[model samples]
Target: MVDLRALFSSNDPVGSAEAFTNRQNQWGLVATAIEDHLRHIADPGFNVEDLETSRNNVVHFHGVGGVGKSTLLRKIEASLTAADQRPTQ
Candidate 1:
């Protein structure tokens, strides 16, 4: 598991981003809820071959500041960007 205490304890945003990126380097479940939500948004059905049939293309995560909201957004951005670049079967 990621030492979230250490991750969010960074002195700056750059350090925080670096720590967030390295979180998956270790074992353990940290933010399954956030991860699962990101995966659900990246579903092929949402961005399938028929753009006209697509429902929603955007998702919003709302909460008070300093509550790991930015962290979740950055993680999801990385996750979805990687997924979009992958070769399909």
Candidate 2:
């Protein structure tokens, strides 16, 4: 379950990370799409044609209000931020 206070609070980054819950499938899809996009850009051997037909460049999340859309975005942002800070190679 999501922790509502942490979801709504901008001051608590750690709390927000902890509050995010139960969207492993969605997160996995997003992560895979991101990886594919990066590969398309970075890998000379990767077929750009395949990416044109096989994957979408955008991940759209649509649902009624108050269903944790904002919270999920926050989680994605935190994850990407952490990944960006990691040492490469």
Candidate 3:
């Protein structure tokens, strides 16, 4: 059986990258949204008017407690951090 103590011991939701798993669909959704947002912002003709019928830059994740919601968010944050540190082409 898995131990809950180890998971709860750390203040960090995700203990490490290795501990995060099985959320490829969620990750893909978030990553795509972020990429689209960045691409839109980088466009010279992009304006707030363009979002009139769009998602308004919001992505929501909802589930019962202790279902790895925080963990998923932390993993996304880590991914974004790693991406930010990479050299731009």
Candidate 4:
């Protein structure tokens, strides 16, 4: 798993964003994908304890009209489909 403490605990917001985006916690199916990506790094201690964590299932956003929220969601859906990512969020 990725170490997020350094990113959030740091002073730079932009760097934090970069680190966060680069590190995504995917579990169940998404976690499976993560495991696949990290298969090469397989250590005997790969318990993946972080994957056991739960997150809110909701996607929250607030914006003015015609802000492409639907479009953005659709794009996300398409990518998930391509990745065969089942919703466990």
Give lDDT per model, in order. Answer: 0.51, 0.68, 0.69, 0.46
- The residue-by-residue lDDT of candidate 2 on 1-89, one tens digit each, is 75766555544444434534588888888899899889777878667666455655788998644555677777777767767674332
Q: How does each model score on TM-score?
A: 0.31, 0.54, 0.58, 0.30
Better of 2 and 3 by lDDT: 3
* Candidate whose TM-score is highest: 3
Better of 2 and 3 by TM-score: 3
Off by over 4 Å in 2: 1-20, 45-55, 82-89
Scored by lDDT, model 1 comes in at 0.51
Instruction: Highest lDDT: give the candidate number.
Output: 3
* Candidate 3 lDDT tens digits, 1-89: 44657656655454344444688888888989999989978889777665465555788998544557777777666766777674342
Give candidate 3's error at residue 88 in angstroms.
25
List where candidate 1 sits over 4 angstroms from the true fold.
1-54, 83-89
Please list all clashing residue pairs in model 3, or write none if there are none: none
Lowest-scoring 10 consecutive residues by lDDT in candidate 2?
A: 10-19
Candidate 2 pairs with clashing backbones: none
Q: Is candidate 3 or candidate 4 better by TM-score?
A: 3
- TM-score, candidate 2, is 0.54
21: Cα error in model 1, Å = 15
